[model samples]
Target: MTRHMPISETQDAPPRRRITLPLAPPLEQRRLQLYIALLLLDGAAILNGFCIASWLYLGRFLDETSLLHSQVMLPIYWSIALSLQVYTLTALRRPNFARARAGLSLIGAETVLLFVGFATKSTDNFSRVSSLLGLGLSLVLLMWVRALVRPLIKARCGDAVTNTLLIDDGGTPLRIPHAYHIDAREHHLAPDLSDPHMMDRLGLYMMNMDRVMVSCPHDRRAAWALVFKSANVSGEIVDPEVNMLGVLGARRERGYGALIVASGPLGLRARAVKRLLDLALAGGAVLALGPVLLLVAVLIKLEDGGPVLFIQKRTGRGNRFFPIFKFRSMRVERLDSTGSRSASKDDDRITRIGRFIRSTSIDELPQLFNVLRGEMSIVGPRPHAIGSLAGEKLFWEVDHRYWLRHSLKPGLTGLAQVRGLRGATDTETDLANRLQADLEYLDGWTIWRDLKIIVNTARVLVHDRAF
Candidate 1:
């Protein structure tokens, strides 16, 4: 029995047995506890598996001469297990227990073990037979532990999951255990396929949910697919004909149905790593470019004596507004607040230094501050000013798909920018083309993708179209 903490002992039991109250913690806290417990359990299993394997092959625990050797090996095993990302595979995102994940993770563990065996000359300490058996046993225990725990987690967090559609006009019993059945006729949060605000709310709701069963127009399938998978939510639907996957590059994430899908990609620790990288890179850029930025600031002040930074509101994730920073490369007095006019080549409103910065894409440098502020990613869809236009029409008026770009934080530079789609939307075709690139970035996002964009962006920095 897995005993959840935030519990207290009761004095009614005899001898050694004591009763504990079901003092359930907050949802997020409980989820964190579950993750920590899983890591600890896997770590312990690795140690135990090694002990058993050692005895089987060498007739002693770790075949070590001293307990000190075992203690040193204990931390090493834990370190190796963590570095292999063994816990990550357990952060499932599909509808089933992915026993395959354990096998894949074991392969990774085995490879890492082989590297360590050679590096540390572990073959000289323990026989090859012991090493292989120990690894096999550890992974076996990992899979076995997950097989037992996944069901319990599903049952416990079941309201956050829906195996069957609970949407109804009225009076339908939700068949799935702990499913949050909605009387669609009266439920304010019921998904409205046509309303963008409603879709946003539903997407927000999905951040707390795992598998969600929804019914909407067939044409709107792509929108829901972007919303659900971007949020990492998955589910089963009775209507087999309603599939919107691969349209905008959304793929069905199998093996996560039984597990909770927290918002975004790459699990908790992976996200932390990405976040750390963002801060490091952004912070480093600010420091590395300090002299260039100061020079630009002086030049801007010398020309107009206005704000060095052109702080403007741009749409961020979930259509939330955040201030994006740029070096003011335009005459402050002539800046277009409505986004009605797009900058063109050799615009008179841009001063000499402005022309240089704007052309060199140096004006976008201050967005590193936005990245450091957590208002933007180092790479993603570039944040467009509100009321940004495509020809004579506002971007949102161009298509509903335009709004889907807000699914992630806007970036300093993006797939569209690096791919020569930067500066001026002169036609609906241009706007549509950029939207496609943005969708591509969102659906196929990775740290590597970000790095590639960053590298590619340098080549186009002085392009003619930028101004």
Candidate 2:
């Protein structure tokens, strides 16, 4: 969590002036509100169209039969409209598309109403001439309302449908129309992964943006790609060869091109479900294991009169640092908080009680609190300590994809742990095996898969490599 100098600034240089650029509000965030507004406006248009038709053709503004027809037609039209994408972002952006969809929905609704009326043997519900006039007027009104709102929508949401941020990170120069651009040198913005505060600074610039495109040098592309993945944002790198590689996707606009690198794995609903599962399981485990936790705390405290819990900073979601809790399995004097030293069998650092807890994997039970705090999940890639290494190389040095695993919250137990990939990573091959499992877990996540992983974790609690 160390704070460093701004991305481009040095200690000897004078403070850089912060510049604020014009930014459009994120349209994606306000889409729900716009949809509701469009729905209400369409409803009003339908009701007024029917009333005018009733007055001109039926000699009454709001006859009971006409009112009933409008009521019956509204819900049917709405359902049809939703199915036709009449109330979506595309509808808002294209007036012609919106009008055509609205018209189609109206026809579908009228056809459904007539069929239902005939089925019920009540075909005389209203005059055919009046109904025909009402349909024609409603169609006109729908098209008028849709056309009228196009200019207003443009004024509000800008020319681009999604909010975009362009970062000029000492790479090729490019411009995205209607996108907010910031000079990395002027803003003092750098993607320093080791510094949580710097990541936070970069995150602020990306706030409310649907996509972030970085124009950085070739050397920095990997670093920026990792940053984007860890942040779980839709990210793109400016490169013409991107389309040739057939990566995620490519965006070519005007004379500039970019390659999409990262996108969020879970949607809003999926995230909500996952979070609820974590809260329910973590909360229940705390209460059910209350006695065991208490006994362990007492034993750890009495063993050497040391702290009951061992807290060490581990890399969590978004490549941020979070303190993970364990039941103080190592002696106070011998504890390796930085995790530079890996535990091994017959290690003298473990106390008598620590030996029992570490062997049984009871030392890890305290991490339920991390799950409750939303820092960890019941099943995911295990968080690695900042200084953890495989053989002589650091974990990230062994595999750059290590950062991608942090895109999701670290877990109490992971696919690696259940597959017997736990304990000391003695070599690069050991770390690579675990990293492969972690990456595989990310490909097609499902609630059922997570449940299966949790079930599998129970059988390996007392693993051979745990100590």
Candidate 3:
């Protein structure tokens, strides 16, 4: 018979293991439903306010004019509110923020209605006293309903609006309010990419989590980064050094901190605005530059009977590669597709028309098509060829942050190009200077700034740096 080893005498006794913690239920599905409910409630409050006001003023539940006003105001308010992020996860967690956005949206909508009414000479149709009462009551109801939903949001999302899981793997200590903390050792967890079962365990812990953050020793960060990349979640690694590296912002909460590495720099509204701008300008530029483009294509073809356009692989948004279009400037036989050779003063490979077009920035006109195709932008960091070099090293080798510039679509003319930071990068300093400007452009992007950049670009179309 098998005799169990005595606890005191045995050297191989198994230690007691802690029970695995239960995984937190997914909050995203419930949170979406809550958002829909809040939206309906807001609409109801607006309609009820207008209905009640009409009854108080005209002894009717729904005055024809008042109902019409509510209908118009409702769409306007929703449009403005969406742009202001009134219906976001942040708004759900912070009721005051939601209330403020709602109030501002209402005020803006009312102002718009007033302006339109005056412009259209329809003020007489809308009762001034009734409108005023509706506005006041709408504000009251919006605030009340938002406040009422706070507890419900809390119940659904927990204290943290996001499902945040903090995995401590023998790294820096951190604590965040309502975030699930798991000790890697206790759960027998490791970023073991080779072991399928270990990965399965990791996936279970991160299941339904909106954000998975890991604080691990420097040696393991790479493995964790790879793990998180395929995890289909917003993953962040806790690294305080990102502050020194000029991170966009920081969140300090309950002694827990993280640096946002990979995120969309532009929000939904901003992206929509930027895309609209891109389409308008790119479309217009293509039409306006049609003659110039046709002339250049004929010249390039006539010069050597070769391809009119040169397509080179360049790094684009998310560090992905895309073919960039340019008017073929070099001889077909001597073409450097890899862009390994920087065009210097009096480069022998440049054709006669190529030199003129490059200096005049006319060759870049073809990229208007790239902008229209949504592969590039009118204003952003310029994309570089994969083999492009600074000094003797590649651009990314010069600075690790070099890849960060590709976070947005490469632009025809960027802050760097407009600032006269163009041409071949002969040294590391050239890239550094341009990189600094690109980073500056990435922050606080706006339509006004983009328009300004376009205007400024025209002034630098014939810079000395252009080869």
Each model's TM-score?
0.61, 0.73, 0.60
Candidate 3 lDDT score at position 415: 95
lDDT of 2 by residue, 58-91 (tens): 7899888888898899999999999999987688
Q: Per-residue lDDT of 1-467 in model 3, one digit per residue for the tens?
A: 11121122225647644334336777766876887798888888888888889999999978999989988999888889889989898898787899999999999999999999999999899888998999899899999999898888888888777888899999888876778887787667898754434554566677677778889999998777656644445678887666555566644333455655344467546877898999999999889888989999999999999999999987676444678999999899999988877888789999999999999999888898899888899998998877788899877667656655765788999999989999989999999999999889878888899999999999999989899
lDDT of each: 0.64, 0.84, 0.81
Q: What is the lDDT of candidate 2?
A: 0.84
Tell me, by TM-score, which candidate is best: 2
Clashes (candidate 3): 0
Q: Model 2, 240: alpha-carbon shift in Å?
A: 5.8
User: Candidate 2: where is the Cα deviation over 4 Å?
Assistant: 1-163, 186-208, 218-223, 240-248, 302-305
Which sequence of candidate numbers ranks them by lDDT, best first? Answer: 2, 3, 1
Over 1-467, each residue of candidate 1 has an lDDT whose tens digit, in order, gives 12222212337524443222111222443555666777677667666776788888778875662232334445555565455444443453332334454456556655665577689886466566776777788768877877777776666544342233344333223344555544344435543434445654454444344446544445544545554544344533323221433322222332221212224544555556667878999999999999999999998999878889888876677555678888988888898765678898867888788888888889999999888988888878888876678898778778766766776778888899888998899898899999999988767457777778889988988887989
Candidate 3 positional error at 82, Å: 6.2
Deviation of model 3 at 213, angstroms: 4.7
Could you tell me the lDDT of residue 397 within candidate 3?
A: 65
Total backbone collisions, model 1? 6
